[model samples]
Target: MKIRRANKEDVTAIVEMLANDALGEQREDYKLPLPDSYYRAFHKIDSDPNQELMVAENKEGIVIGTLQLSLIPYLTYSGGLRAQIEAVRIHENYRGKGLGKKLFLWAIERAKEKNAHVVQLTTDKKRPKALRFYESLGFKGTHEGMKLHI
Candidate 1:
């Protein structure tokens, strides 16, 4: 498996992976409505300087997994940076093969390269397995992430 930066051409596979429940777990409130234009918008935003969107591809050039890393610069910590990991997904058939780990580690390295002070992510409470996985990767549940439906 090859991990690399995602390009606009990979949007279709990325959307499919994002829509899979096993990967994204997006609830009805946060569900991603798939449309051709959605991919275009995502590509545009992901290419901006503050964001890094990546994809994991197999030898066949199929995008099997993906994640996004966003860098938020801060003034409070003396110009420190925070890297937020989101939109992690792997194709159902490719799960349990350590692809997630590789992609996550790649994101961490990318964050370090950008001089980020911390890396953060959030997962639903129902996903105990995913929570454990994140723990094993040195991430801790530090706070409650509350959302309000608009």
Candidate 2:
């Protein structure tokens, strides 16, 4: 397996994996000829120096996982940089293969390279299994995360 920055051609596979889960079925659109909005968002993220949209590929060059890491400079933590990881998804066939752990370890190291003070992520409350998976990776449930859908 190889981890690398994602390209425009990778969006479809990434979205397909993202939409494979139960919660994803409600929120992600994995249709062929995906809405151009996905590309537009990709371009915007690609242009940002602090953003790293990554994909993991198997030996056959099939995209199996993806995640987005973003760095935000904050006034707290003594003007520190915080790394936010989001949209982590592993293809159905790739789950339990340790691809997700490898991807996250890479992202954590990447954050350290960028001098980020901390790396954080939020998972849906609906995903208890994911919560345990995250805890296994040394993440703590230190704070409550809240959101309001508009």
Candidate 3:
């Protein structure tokens, strides 16, 4: 599979993978002619110099996975850059084929290219298997993550 920066045309496939799982089924609205919000969000992310929204395509050029990597400048880590990996999703039909690992390897390499001091991500507690998968990637549960909805 080839990994590259995502183009506008890849949004639908990205969202499809994003919505294929149980948690995604609750939070994502995936359909043909997706809501304009997805497009708007895509445009905003696309315009941001700090954000790299990526897509992975199979040999036939079908989008099979996606992730968002954001570079954040912060006072912590000695005023260094932090690469935040989020919204990682692999197409349902493509799971268990090592595409997720490939996607993550690409992201981590990109993070290193950007000179990020650290790479970080948050996963929902409901997904224990996902937690294990991330551990296998060499990520540690170093801190407690908290959030509040508006």
Please write out the lDDT profile of model 2 over residues 1-150, one tens digit for every residue: 899999999989988888898988899877889989889999999999989999999999999999999999989989999999999999889899898999999999999999998999999998999999999999999999999999
Ranked candidates, highest TM-score first: 2, 3, 1
Better of 1 and 2 by lDDT: 2
Better candidate by lDDT, 1 or 3: 3
Candidate 2 to native Cα RMSD, angstroms: 0.7
**Could you tell me which residue pairs clash in candidate 1?**
none
What is the C-alpha local distance difference test score of candidate 1? 0.84
- Clash pairs detected, candidate 2: none
User: Model 1 — TM-score against the truth?
Assistant: 0.87
- lDDT-based ranking: 3, 2, 1
Clashes of each: 0, 0, 0
**In candidate 1, what are the lDDT values of residues 53-72, reduced to their tens digit?**
88998999889999989999
Model 3, position 62: C-alpha lDDT score: 94
Q: Which ranges in model 1 have alpha carbons more than 4 Å from their true place?
A: 22-34
* Model 2 regions more than 4 Å off: none
lDDT assessment of candidate 2: 0.93
Q: Can you list the residue pairs that collide in candidate 3?
A: none
Better of 1 and 3 by TM-score: 3
